[model samples]
Target: MTEQNRLKQIIEAALLAAGKPLSLDEMIGLFAESEQPEKKRLREVLAELTEDYDGRGIEVTEVGSGFRIQVRAEFSPWVSKLWVERPPKYSRALLETLALIAYRQPITRGEIEDIRGVSVSTNIIKTLTEREWVRVVGHRDVPGKPALYATTKEFLDYFNLKSLNELPTLAEIRDLDSINRELELQDPDKVSDEQPDGDAKAAEGGEEDPETQQDGDDAIPTDEIDTESTVKESEAEAEPEVFAESSDETDSFDHLDSAETPSAEDDTSDQQIDVDTEPMDDAEQPETEPPAVALSDEEQTPLKTEIDE
Candidate 1:
């Protein structure tokens, strides 16, 4: 059989076996013939097959785990018209949260909380997340490490919006005063230079404030110790004079005081040990001359010395 025909038969059998949407990867694994099967061609074939079934009683939708051939939702009204049972209605909080997300996309939970004036319900988010309508787009570089959530492409399909920009403006969002607008003000995509853990490289080797830099990835170390002895030694050499000269309360360099540094006593001990071994290091060190003449005042008075001379 031709590749297309064989693939059609394979997909038809896979559909029968899966009884649900089959993912692109799943199909590739099943029909991947040789080393690196032609995935692009396969995708094209799948698209063609999906198009072939478009006008029929069924539709192909990418949902949950994979793509599936399911009855057209547009026909749900005609099919279920007799029974007339409505789909479950979402609660007010869920709808409000969804609307906020749908309108001001890529928003963080803290922003949502701020707008709602109440702590966000995890279950509301969980339900939206489970529905696959909302997804983590990015995070805010803020104190709490809040995740930025946005409506997905499936959200667009479900809500019948073409794109995020097509959503009604905040000025028009039904009777809810705009707060997520501020939430949308912070865009992770715009701040692409920052780290996932919120580590941002400041201008001229300056450090980004920790409060302003992290989004709370638990795998990252919250505090990084300067383990290099050189750093401690340099700070030890610098601190007394550094503090004496600076009076700025805002200076973060004051962190040097909190950090462990080599003290003067430690340096004195090191110097005493070094002095005992200075002879060995003489080649590497400057040499000093020993005293050659000694004066004894009792040996000769000034008048007696003059007469004798």
Candidate 2:
């Protein structure tokens, strides 16, 4: 292979092998400094690799982090079947919170709550943080100085976005519902189930609040409705064994109980014998009279007189 062709092949292999996105610096490190290709040449190879995978099952794409070879979104439905466990579904509230953070980054929790017109659940924040989608950028300069959140590179990678600029414009979103629809089109893999939870339902019911309502141009997109399956066949397969083990435990307990238990007649006879033995033992003990105390004659006389009175 020519030097250029060899470089392309190396870049393609690196991206394919990398489970996560690889930055330009990391890709450059693959080659010795003396023989390393220029940054521009590396990018050109990456671009060519991306084109080479066009119309193929897997495609090389660039995100905020860098380049990665991933299965295209169009084939995810069929590809996802390989895994037994379904992806996690996010509630509308959680998605809305993420949307607000993505568009109006470095925003505080309070700001998100204000935009949504409902108190943001700690769990939603926790889930986002756990997923590494959002991070603590800094604290707002107000009384509480609430922590501000911004989207991480992982968020872009998850959504297959190259940058924040790739996000849909505010004008495209008429309302929260419209926003969700657009998001669904953009990321079908992430969006699952349209049915909002109790919190989301409540938020929707109160969406008419003036403070929470926004103009057409500024309105944020709502979470898309997701209807993906959550069941894992692998988990279902193991359930029978778990039930069998549990039943075995129960049977062992029952057997132990049967072995330790005495018959009703035996218990009654034992109790009666113990009662009879107790009375006999008591009867065998001799009864003792109280000891008499001698008192002085004068004191006795006074006591007798007082008793008589």
Candidate 3:
């Protein structure tokens, strides 16, 4: 076979046997320094091998770390049966924390807490670190200098992502309200199905048929009816006391009204008296004599004699 064909076969065999992503440097290191193929030629061969696997059960793909041959996700159901062990199940909280770290790299734990609106559990961080999905990149240059975290290559490979840029945009990540609205729009039937029949009837504002109503009444237990009747009787017996209390309140309010009525009448009488006196005083003022009376001759003579003295 030609050298180009042989190179493709060799690369394919190495990827298959490695069972994990192999970096270009690792693949090139396989050959002697002098005999090593050019990086460009290796890439061309890798590309050819990827094309050859197209439409096949497996495919050659590049992840954040490097290249690997993995079974296509479409065939995973059938292929997964070959393994006796079950795949691990991750909690929603863990997945959310991981996504945040992946998208917002170099994020501090406090920052993640702020976004999630809860404290990050130590166990969650421990679990992700143990799984090799995340690692502490560095410390923030602030008070306490919290450690910053970033997604590792294993995280990308597991999610089938080539890089952080492959992640969904912030706009694409729907908020809880938008997600709930979308769910409501997508499958209204599902939401309806979850509701009880009585609630659905209430929502529709429809009355139950006579037969259904009779059936529901018949389904009530005898003891429940007795209890309900007893409650009604107790309420009826206590109603006289309630009415008596209310009557007492009414009597007190009537007393208050009676007490206030006299004062109001007194105020009206005072106002009326002032009004009557005002007109009488104006009318009498014109009839009353002036204080300046004409001086008698004897009084004038005494005043003149006093002035002369």
Candidate 4:
């Protein structure tokens, strides 16, 4: 077999013999031999080996600062069904705390607590210890010294990380914060109050345009007002006045058309003509008297009394 393939077989043998995940650093010493394989060469070989397993059931994954070989998660249920084994579940919060410590090893619990913003309960520390995920790496030399913790090989194996560097980037961490904040916004009740007032004020500050504000300032000369609102205002004002004038003229023409016109004669002449055209009086002609029949003396007496004769 070629040297790289030989190295791959050696690494695989080591993993199989070890029966667990191994750190690149730990694997480094083993790869160190009479040949004295360079770190770069080992990494390339490991990469080539990892790629070989891509389509296969086994995989090489990095967690914390190390690497391990394991079956892919998709096949877990089938493999688990055969073995009657289900892996232990780590609550996301607990995993976050563990990952922080794993990547930032020799980290104090206070710092972890600060990151978590809650007191670290004893059970959390104990569970990690029992699971062999974390170990008491060392203690700080500072005052009132606190114990420092670091992730173990088990953490690497569990997470399938090749090395601490292979752990997700710090940028990814910041993105996680953003994503979490967004999730918090998904809850309707806390959205308004949860956002910091200072952050909001800062956002409002960045968005403020001083020039725009200055444009709105009252100190501007009257010339500016005449310049800005003048055109629109003039158009608005002139249109209605023009419409009104046109309407007035139209109405005046209509009134003139519908007016009661005088006759061709002058007003005085018309009045004289009106007097000349009067009807002849009913009493001026004998024909006005109705033809009468003879009446009895009593009727004639009543009629003579009504006529005052």
Candidate 5:
């Protein structure tokens, strides 16, 4: 074989056997000092290898770390069967946290929580660190000295990404449903119902609010109404009744006060009282309803005369 053919075979063997990506320097180190090829010639060989894999099941890919030989994504379904263990299932929360770290590096956990509107779980961070997909680049100068996180080359390798630049833009990320479909980041538990959640619900299929329901052909779902605003509106409607009841109570109390006080317009309304009037003591028996009494013959004399007349 020619020297060029030998060099290609050596590099290919190193890549396949390494079980990980190998940089150009590492690939070149596979040869003796005198037989090592220059980077330019190595690039040519890699190009040739890529072309050789154009229609093949496996291909040579250059990710952020270096070049690797991996099975093409098209053959994953079959290639995946070689492994007995089921792929680890990632929750949507974990995927989202990862995406944030990838897109916005040197970001703090608090900042991630701010964007996600929920606190990041400890397990999510631990998993990323354990996987070597993320690392603390530095600490922020702010209070508490929060550790700033950034994605590592292994993350790119796992995703088959060339670099951070190859990641989807924020605008593309905004189309979460489509991106989720492309990335297969759906959480089986959450998506079992097949209904979208969070920001995706509004963006995908224009789904109606869960609060509202459709009855028939005549009913069309209205826009998602704010529950808080609805509650405020109901309170506003109930305010007048509350005010009227309070006003009535106030007026009744005022009437009672007025009755107890002497009034110039109604002098005859005051009851006749003697100077020897005495207030009842606590020991006195409480007043009870008057009892009926039978009248004597003299008391009935006036009633008998009136009836006879």
Candidate 6:
């Protein structure tokens, strides 16, 4: 092969074998001192290789880290099938936190929390750092001296981005839902919060969102428990008052009957005593008289003579 073609072949082999991005300096270092090509010639070779890969399943990509060979995005679906293991899923919180770092570099944790309106978890920061997607650029000049974060070249490389300029503008984002769908991250938190695309389409056709169903499943029981407790409490409170009032009324009626009975007995006994002591008219006298009545006849005759006088 010609020397120029050999140089191109060498560069291509270096990129494919590296398994990661390589800068011009790194590529040049692979050659001997006498054989190293100039930076301009290297860039020209890289550009020519990029053109050659235009219609292929794989392409030469330039990322923030430098250049690398990667499968074109269109072929990833079929290519990914080669691996049985699925990609690791990240949480929506983690994704959003990463997004903030990428979009607003040199931002502090407190600043991210302020924009998100929720506190960022330490685990999420640790995860991003561990992945080498983010790093502490510097500390803010404040009392607490919070670390300012920025996106690393690994972040750009993973996302297949050339630079921060390649990111979609805020207006172009539309919503996180669309972005998440495009990324196909399938974050568990996002999945829990949003209905599936099929369910969403079904909802548009008059079915309910699955998320609402899940919420109902969780929320309805709580409402029912509260309602049942309130009803039972009200019933319990009403029952005692009803029983107490009935008992009080019954006791009052018994007291009234007892008091009236003694008064009635006393009145009847006084009436009998009055009848025994008062004199009885002749018409009211007994038809049969006792023997004592004859002894009293002489006394009665004097009493009768005095009555006639």
Highest lDDT model number: 6
The models' CA-based lDDT, in order, is: 0.71, 0.84, 0.83, 0.73, 0.84, 0.86
After superposition, candidate 1 runs with Cα above 4 Å error: 16-20, 32-36, 61-66, 78-86, 116-119, 129-139, 151-309
Clash tally, candidates in order: 4, 5, 0, 11, 0, 0
lDDT for residue 133 in candidate 3, whole number 0-100? 96
Q: Which ten residues in a row have the lowest lDDT in candidate 1?
A: 177-186
TM per prediction? 0.43, 0.56, 0.57, 0.43, 0.58, 0.57
| Comparing 1 and 6 on lDDT, the stronger one | 6
Q: Residue 105 in model 1: shift from native, Å? A: 4.0
What is the TM-score (0 to 1) of candidate 3? Answer: 0.57
Residue-wise C-alpha lDDT for candidate 4, range 1-309, written one tens digit per residue: 787788889888887677656666677788436766777877887788788898999887656545667778999777777765566787766766776686568898888877667778788888999988899978999898999999886776566654566676543455455333422323433345557876877788897566655644556765777887989888999999999999999999888866766545667798788878977677864575679898999889988899996
Query: For candidate 3, lDDT tens digit of each residue in 1-309?
Result: 998898888888999899889989989998888889988998999898888889999998999889999999999999999999999998777877887787668899988887777788999999999999999999999999899999899988888889888976544555533333422333455456657876877868666454544454458665788999999999999999999999999999999998877887799998999988775646566676769879999899999999999
Better candidate by TM-score, 2 or 5: 5
C-alpha lDDT (0 to 100) for residue 263 of candidate 6: 79
lDDT of 5 by residue, 71-125 (tens): 9898999989999999899988888889878867889999988777789999999
Tell me the lDDT of model 2 at 11.
86
Q: How many backbone overlaps does candidate 3 show?
A: 0
Residue 189: error of model 4 in Å?
20
Instruction: List model 1 lDDT by residue over 1-309, tens digit each.
Output: 886687776776786678756767888788436733466866776777788887898866555456666667778778877776777799878887888787667888877788777878999999999999899988788887789999886776565455676776554543553443443533444346445435433444466465656475643443443455667888898998777667565354666764556678888999999989767655787778988776578655775789889
Lowest summed-lDDT stretch of 10 residues in model 5?
267-276
What 10-residue stretch in candidate 6 is worst by lDDT? Answer: 177-186
Candidate 5 overall Cα lDDT vs. reference? 0.84
Winner by lDDT between candidate 4 and candidate 2: 2
lDDT of 6 by residue, 1-309 (tens): 999999999999999999999999999999999999999999999999989998988999899899999998888999999999999999988988888787778899998887777899999999999999999999999999999999999999899888999997654565675444433444665567566876777768675445655553455665777999999999999999999999999999999998876777798998999998999999998899655645477788988899999
